[model samples]
Every structure is written in C-alpha cells, then in structure tokens.
Target: MKRSRAVSLGILGAAAFGLAACQTEEQTDAAAFSDEQSCVAAAAQSGWFTREDCAATFAEAKAVHEETAPRYESQALCEEEHGAGACGGDPAAASGGGGGSIFMPLLAGYLIGQALGGGRAMAQPVVPKAGGGFATPTGGTQLSRLNSTGKMGTTAFAKGPTTAGQPPMSRAAVASRGGFGGSAATRSVGS
Candidate 1:
C-alpha cells in the first residue's frame, strides 16, 4: 500500500507539471498568418513591414497571382494598410476598383480647411453690434459691416479721418429707437 501511494503521488505531480507548461502565453505567433488578410493586419500592426513585405510574404504564401507575385487590392487600400505607393496595381486603374492615392484626399481636406479659414492660427470672431450688425472684431477692411437684413449699415464701420468740409458718412452716433432705422450714410474715398 505504501509503494502504491508513492507511485500515485508521483504520477499526479508529473501531470500537474505537464498541465502547467500548456498555460504559457509565449506560444509561437509566427504561423498566425493563416491567410493574407490576417498576416497583413498583424504585420501592419507591428509598423515594421511595408507593402513589399505583404506582397512577398502574404501573396507568396498562397500563390496569389499568375502575373504578379501577390495581387493587391487597390493603391489606396494598400497605402492605408501599409504606406504610400505600397500597392502593386496602377493607381489610376485602381480608382474604380479601389480608392487611389491617399495624399490627394489629405490634400483636398487641407485645402477645404484653408478655404473655410479654419486652418488660420487666429480666426476673426464675429462681433455683435448695437444695431444688430455683425462684424469682425477689428471691423475688417470694409468701411461698413452688414446688418441682419443683409444690408450694409453704419453700426460697425471702420472710422477714418473725417473730411474737413464733408459730413460723416455713417449715422452710427445717431441714437435711434429699437436699435434700427438709422439714416443711411454714403462712404467716400479720398477727396
């Protein structure tokens, strides 16, 4: 009985040891690339592999194409997954098949931002005037700012030197009821 108990304990210890070895997370991930998509995603996630790496390893893994080693989707998709100029196909031809150069979209986004003045370091804020006129903080280069009715009023005009003989063109100083209905002023250039 004593010998049998010892043998059973030894067997149990060996089984525990074997089970412990199976719980390791360091299992090899090298063969994790069962297909091109998974391999591309993994390699791209590492940020080390390029498009050539994808074509060479992934495409070659499955005998991708007869003409090409590993056929790629589109330049745009490839560039997105890899880097610029990473795709194997012609960029123009791939436009209908897949998106083209990624730079063009980025460039277009930059231009759109610039056109809306969103890219400016300091954008001019819309200032509220007493006569319901909206103007920039500095009143801009224009002599008069537009009012709510889309008409140029005298509420927020940039003040220049008053003419020696001519009267002021803006009625901004004139006090009116309900903040509207002020007399129109004629703006004049150099006399």
Candidate 2:
C-alpha cells in the first residue's frame, strides 16, 4: 500500500510538469499570431482544436477587435496586426514614434564647417521683394563676399559648377562626390 501511494504521487508530479511545459509552448505559439485569420489558421493547423473551437476563437477575436485597443510591440507588429499602411495614422501602443532633435546637429555642423573653411558659401536663390529690389536676406551671407573680384570663400570652385547644363550641383552633391573620402579633387580625378 505504501509503495502504491508513492507511485501515484510520482505520476501526478510528472503529469503536472508535462502540462506546464506544454502550456509554455502554447504561449510562444500564441505570440506568433498578429491577427485573427493567421491566429485561427495556426490553431487549425496545430490539430489541437475542433472545427467548432476554431470558429468560436475567431469570433471572439473579431469581437475583441471591435472593442479594445491593439497593443503593438513595434510599428512592424502593428502593421502585421492590421496590414501594410494600416499603422500610418498612429496606432495605440506603438514604440519609437516621437520626433527627435533633427535641427540641432544640422545647425551645429553648418556653423562648425563654416568656421573650418571647408564649407562652400552658396548664393541664395534670388527672391524678389515686393517693390522689385532684392529681398533683405533673413540672415546675412556666411562671410562677406571674400573679395571684390567675386572671390567668395574657398580657393576651390568659387561658384558651384553645373552639370550637363543642369542647375549647379547642390551642396550635398559637392560634399558627397565620390565613394569614401570624396572631395572636389577626387571627383575631378575620376572624370
């Protein structure tokens, strides 16, 4: 009698451990479903649910979709939950959506580059004033036109050069000319 009782207890403990392990696998599988159709299909594929159980589960998910907010772990998760372009107009619980300080670094780099003499001073596109004279520049030119003969800042190309009669190349084009370590000289070396 004592041996039988110990054997029964051991079986029960093993059963409990097996059930716990199964529940963990089920939870991981649950996390893989981003929406109702996929979830229902996965449940059906697993062969653990009856046809009636799959229908009931899908109905419950549909009802929940009408009532509660979606908790998305990331923009990607939200997009997967709904569909592509679904998260464009802000969804609940999306992470990493806030604006950052984009202008600070741009302004700092502009000022630093200007000080270092590596910066090219650009002629602002002419904007006509109300009366016909040139509009007063909001901020004056970077450095006073370097000399009277129209030598602006650098000894390099005074005014940005044009390409194939197209408009003059932009500052960015000038900055990122060739592959690594690109400069005006590097661009000329290629062509």
TM-score winner:
2
Q: Give the TM-score comparing model 2 with the true structure, all chains together.
A: 0.21
Model 1 spans > 4 angstroms off = 1-31, 64-191
Candidate 2, superposed: residue stretches over 4 Å from native? 1-45, 70-84, 87-191
lDDT of each: 0.23, 0.22
Local accuracy of candidate 1 as per-residue lDDT tens digits, 1-191: 00000000121121101112223211111112223454345444543343345445433322211111111233343233223543344333335354332211110000000112222211112222232222222222111221111111122122323221222112232233111111222123211
- Would you give me the overall lDDT of model 2? 0.22
Residue pairs with backbone overlap in model 2: none
- What are the per-residue Cα lDDT tens digits for candidate 2 across 50-146? 3444344445433332222222224443333233444332222123354321000001001000112332211211111121121101111122111
